[model samples]
Target chain A: MKEHLFEYLLRLGDDSLILGHRVSEWCGHGPILEEDIALTNISLDLIGQATSLLKYAGEVEGKGRDEDQLAFLRLEHDYKNCLLVEQLNGDFGMTIMRQFLFDAYRLPLFEALIHSSDSQLAAIAEKSLKETKYHYRHSAEWVIRLGDGTEESHERIQKAVNSLFKYHVDLFFTNHVDDALLKEGIVPEMKAIHNKWMESVKNVFSEATLEIPSNNWEQSGGRLGRHSEHLGLLLAEMQYMQRAYPNMEW
Target chain B: MSKNDWPLWEVFIRSKQGLNHKHVGSLRAADAEMAIENARDVYTRRSEGISIWVIESNNVYASDPSDMDSLFEPSQTKVYRHPTFYVVPDGISHM
Candidate 1:
């Protein structure tokens, strides 16, 4: 049970770590300067969440491995981040779509996990829930504006939506870690989580004048340490400093 | 420039809804919707505003720098326009 809990926390931590890094790439390259700052703010929030989750995972593992160690030292096969997060930032529309989909899943997941039997997990979830609520709102608003805006924007954003929809299904899929956490009351009901996620996504999509894809096939493997092509390159950049200068710290 | 490169917008933020909007910064966006998004991103990241307004920088009218003296110097001598001319009643506690 302890091992499973640790794995669950690591999955959460890795997802945040990967997505944070991906979004941080847009810090200075946003379409507008204000959006640059906003994306960076969201990235910082995700990184903060990763720190908390990884720190808790370390405590559970009792191996003295800190968040930095977990984040920088992990191999490609060892990472448990969802494939959705490691995806390339093709364009502004793609970025917004990526964020909206993940935020949709995370906001409700955090809301439910706040009541976990594990107080550390609950505390982390409680704090992240506030940030995720804002993240979700921000992304949802952008999705609507882009989808319903000018012809060029509508077409581009809709294309981004269609391409990214395939990855959204992996967010709610329960695995062995989930099974163990459920048994211990360390996590909430997955079916209920899925339902809430669907409702939220549907509400946003409807308002955005976007269509929800009918395809049921979803990509996976992040839970089992598999990832899309993008993860390795992102990890190379993120882990470079720590990997090159082992034991160096300020 | 392509339509994607919208005009520059000046962002004004009110710390609270009832407060006056103050010029905070500028951002380039393709439209009013994007301008508002950019303004929210740039100026309000630190919870600095309760509301935001974005107007195209080109659309705003500004007083010419050469007109500064003529536009303002005469007002200083208009003491009758000042509220200080009114004597407050001694019993007006709140005032």
Candidate 2:
């Protein structure tokens, strides 16, 4: 049970940590100043969430691994994030699309997790849900604006939507670890969360005039640590400082 | 490159429930919603406010600096309008 819980926590923690890292890459690169600050603020919130989750995971594992160690010392294959989060940020349209999809999934997941039998998970979810609500609003608004804006914006974001739709399925990926936790009432039912996610996606996409792809193919495996080529490059940069200067403290 | 220049807005924040919204700073945004959202990101990252209000910079009307005396010189001499003569009871606080 502890092992399964630890793995589940890693799945949650790694997703936030990696996506936070990805969003932080937009620190100085936002198309507008206000959006730059907004994206960076969201990145900070996600990293803050990652800190709490990874710290709790470390405690559950009973390994002296602190949040820093869990975050900085892990190899690419050890990460248990969804494949959607680890994908490269192609453009503003692509980035916003990625964020919108993830926020749709995460908001409901956190909302359901707030009722978990695990008190620690419930507490973290309660705190994270507030931030996720704001993130969802921001990303959803951007999606609607960009998707329905000028002809160029509409075209670019539509292309992004079609390209990124396949990764959405992996968010609800389940395995034996999840099954055990689900039976124990430690995690929410993925099917219910998926339904809520679909409703939200449909509502927002309808507003944005963006079409969901008819194809249902899904590219997954990040949760099982089978990541794409991108994760290696992301980890190389993320782990560079820690790898080069072992035990160095700021 | 300069095609996307959004309108400027002034941000006002009320730090607590009873406090009045005070102007904090200005930022550029495409609309009122974006202005408020930008204000939230730019001004309230430190948890500095409980509420935010944003107004377009162009919508605000300010008195002319050149007409300072014409607009305000008469008020300086109005000692009767001052509240210094009123004495508060001991129990009354924050008046």
Candidate 3:
């Protein structure tokens, strides 16, 4: 039970940690000053949630490792975020598309997690839900504007959707960890959440006048820790200060 | 990043329920919705406001700076228009 719970917490925490770092990369590089601040603010909210989650995971693991060690010390295979998050933010359109996909999933996931039997997890989900809702709004609005805007924006955003759409399915990757949490009443059913995510995404895409890819190609393995090459590069950049000078603080 | 022609918007924020929406600043956005969202991100990130209002900068008509004397100089000497002559009763503090 402890092992399953610990693994579950790590999956949750790693998702936020990796995605938070990815989003923070947009801090200084958004398309406009307002967008720059908006992206960084979203990144800060995700990182703040990651801090709470990873800290709790460390406690649950009963290991000496704290949130910092868990976040920065984990190898690429040991990290459990979906490939969708680790994917490069190709352009403003691509970043908006990627974030829209993730936010759609996370909003429902957090909403359902609010009813978890585990009080700690439920509390975290409740707090993170507000931030996730705002993130969903931001990304969803941008996705629509980009998809339905001018000719160039429509073309660019369509290309982004085509490229990023493959990763959306893997976000619902479920196996023993989900089964264990499901049996323990610690998580909502993955299928239900997946359906909710699909409905929401479809509604938004239809409104945005974006087409869904007909091919149902599925990509998985991020949950099991197998990841694309991007995660390694991201980790190298993120962990440099920690690895170069172990235990250093400012 | 290259689209510099996005229209400019003026942002107004109501810090609390009872207050009027005061002009905070300006930002550029593609539309009114985006303007409000951008204003929320830029101005209200630190718990600064409970409501927001945004309008395109072009919609606002302002008095010319050259008209300052004609528009305001006559009112400056009209000190009797001030309502400060009467002291409120002790309990009437908000007046």
Candidate 4:
């Protein structure tokens, strides 16, 4: 049970940490200065969540490992972030689509987790829910605007949606860690979370006049430390400082 | 580049409930709502404000530079317009 919990938290933490790194790459290169700031703000918030989750995972593992060690020292096979998050941030449209999809899942997942039997998990959920709400809204709004605005925007955002749809299945995979959490009442059923996520996405897409792709070949493997090709470069950049200067602190 | 570019907006913030909104800085955004959000990210990451306002930079009309002396300097000597002439009751605790 403890091992499963540790793995579960590591999965969540890696998702945040990797996505935060991807988003942070937009810090100075966003489509606009305001979006640059917004993306960075979201990045910082996700990284903060990652730190807390990773720290808690370390405590649960009864290891001397801390957030920095978990984040910087973890090899490719050790990370459990989803391939959706680790995918390249190809463009503004792609970034928004990915954010909207993940935030859709995360908002409801966090909302349900607020009632977990684990007190610390509940507390983390409570803190994260507020930030996740804003992130969901922000990305959902962009999806609408880009999908419905100009012809060029519509085409690009539609392409993004089509390209990313295949990764949706991995989000709801109920494995051993999920089963244990379910039995312990620590994690809500993924089916419920998936239904809510789908409804939310559908409503937003309908309003945006965007079509939901029918692709069903969902990708998985992040939970088992498998990832797309982009994560190594991302890790190289993110871990540079900590790797170069061990135990460095600001 | 043209498709990627969004309009620029000036950000204003009210630090607390009763405070008036004041201009803090500028950012680029696609629209007013995003401008407000960007303003929050740029200006209030450290709890700097309780409220935000974002306006297109072009929408704002400023006092002419030539009128700066007449418009602002005349107020400096108007300190007599200040309420120092009146004395408050000693028991006026809130004042």
Best by lDDT: 2
- Estimate every model's Cα lDDT from 0 to 1: 0.87, 0.93, 0.90, 0.89
Each candidate's fnat, listed in order, reads: 0.56, 0.75, 1.00, 0.69
lDDT (tens digit, per residue) of candidate 1 on A40-88: 9999999999999999889899999998899899899989888899999
Instruction: Flag regions of model 4 displaced more than 4 Å.
Output: A240-250, B1-8, B57-95
Winner on TM-score (2 vs 4): 2
Q: Give the TM-score of candidate 2.
A: 0.94
Q: Candidate 2 chain A — worst ten consecutive residues by lDDT sum?
A: A214-223
Candidate 1 C-alpha error for residue A169, in Å:
2.4
* lDDT string, candidate 2, A1-250, tens digits: 9999999999999999999999999999998888999999999999999999999999999979999999999888899999999889999999999999999999999999999999999999999999999999999998998988889999999999999999987899999999999999999999999999999999999999999998887899889999989999999999999999998889
Q: Relative to the true interface, what fraction of contacts does candidate 4 keep?
A: 0.69
Backbone clashes in model 4: 0
Query: Judged by DockQ, which candidate is best?
Result: 3
Error of 1 at B88 (Å): 14
Model 4: CAPRI class: medium
Ranking by lDDT: 2, 3, 4, 1
- What would the TM-scores of all predictions be? 0.85, 0.94, 0.96, 0.89
**TM-score, model 2, chain B versus true chain B:** 0.83
1 against 3, candidate with superior DockQ: 3
User: Which candidate leads the pack in TM-score?
Assistant: 3
Off by over 4 Å in 1: B1-10, B14-21, B28-37, B47-70, B78-95
